[model samples]
Target: MEIFTTVWKDWTMYQKSSLLLMGICIFIILISCIYIITRNRRLIIHAIASILCSAIFTVGTMVILHVVFDERISYIYMLIPLVVFLVDIISLSMNLGYYTSTRNKKSFSPISVKKELLRDSLQLSIFIILLFSAISVFMGGALFTFVIAMGATALLIPWTNYLLLYWIYR
Candidate 1:
């Protein structure tokens, strides 16, 4: 633990943030895949949507605050996502237990108006994140690249959500 902590402390701001963000994504994808195993996706899909919102908001705020001020991002940015990842893992485990405990008793309710919006919003955010990630990978996380990626992510989230919501529901 000490060695790992020391190594983490030595990493640059970009490296630390990138590692945390990647961890966030990998955990989210894992949770989503686990969610897919259920016979009904109503709860999981909506849950994914809310999770995505929280993920983007925390990361976006961290990134934007850094970009706008040219300062270091607080660890609060990374910690929130880490906490979410931990929660998701626990939820996934419980979900699996619930699924197996009683085949006749399913907990997920039918999709409602709220669930529909959550699912749609999550889907859109994923698309936007992918588009940005592709661009970032191509450019590489060099100097200024992190800022660009974060800035773009922060700026595009609302636009994407609004556009998708209008296009899909309106």
Candidate 2:
């Protein structure tokens, strides 16, 4: 019980910049997911670029946290980003698989492709949200910071969708 308390206390002490970076990462993931669902080639490219940038930022933030704050790394702290990375990889793999599977099929419908993409997006979103919730539960650092993190995680979905649609149609 005491150990749990200590760990929670430590987790809550995240720096403001670290929290902001994490939020940006989540935003990137959400945008990628939205683009995947839409199947817009141009938008997908932009989202991928954003994802790469965010990944770089996230790694830099992690390094700063480790060196400057002297914080010990833990799997719990990395869970959400790892899951987001996995989801991106999985989505790419699925796209390749779909292309290969349909190579010989003459009657491939755009509707089917859209459906599958939507399904994948929904699954990724659910997993991301669950990961965020789990992380929040074990977070012991700063309560206000945690709340900001939670807000960012929660807002990512709708904000990404809205921005993607607005940009794509504009």
Candidate 3:
């Protein structure tokens, strides 16, 4: 039909990728829910929640900025959710490593891994907020700059958390 053709032609690469990413996120969420139910792993539930929230927020914000405010959304915004998702996967692997490491030790408890992750994530989040604020101030202090800083924060915190955990655990 003519409508299908028009829609197909008008579709941008970003839209295509966004749709794909959303599909992947949905699949992950469903699988994670099943996994949580079967294994009673509450930690994974937190990762699932983070992935869902960050992906939704990133995509929704991009839509609003583009459609409502007529702002030029960058393709880099697409990377945020993907990066967050990847970090979650890596964190899980790292946690598994930590568990094995603790098992081999005489005194270290597995619970310490969760505590360390939570502490590092909180510290990284605080650092990102302060850093973003400082950087945004120097970048002209506009509303748009603030929005950009927030997006960057959403992208940075999980990534930095993963790196810090890797450094400490490895």
Please tell me which predicted candidate would have the highest lDDT against the true structure. 3
Worst 10-residue stretch by lDDT in candidate 1?
108-117
Task: List TM-score per model, in order.
Answer: 0.36, 0.41, 0.49
- lDDT order, best first, reads 3, 2, 1
Q: How many residue pairs clash in each candidate?
A: 0, 6, 0
Candidate 3: pairs in clash: none
Cα RMSD of all models vs. native, in order, equals 12.9, 11.4, 8.3
Candidate 3 structure quality by residue, lDDT tens digits, 77-145: 546565555544554555555655575577665357657666656655666567657666666524544
Cand. 2 Cα-lDDT? 0.52
When 2 and 3 are scored with TM-score, the better candidate is 3
Query: Of models 1 and 2, which has the larger TM-score?
Result: 2
lDDT of 2 at 36: 58
lDDT of 2 by residue, 6-89 (tens): 556776566546866876777677666756565557546645654564355445544555566655545545544554445455
Q: Per-residue error at 14 for model 3, in Å?
A: 9.3
Best-matching candidate per TM-score: 3
Ten contiguous residues with the weakest lDDT in model 3: 37-46
Candidate 1 Cα misplacement greater than 4 A, ranges: 1-32, 60-72, 75-77, 91-96, 106-170
Better of 1 and 2 by lDDT: 2
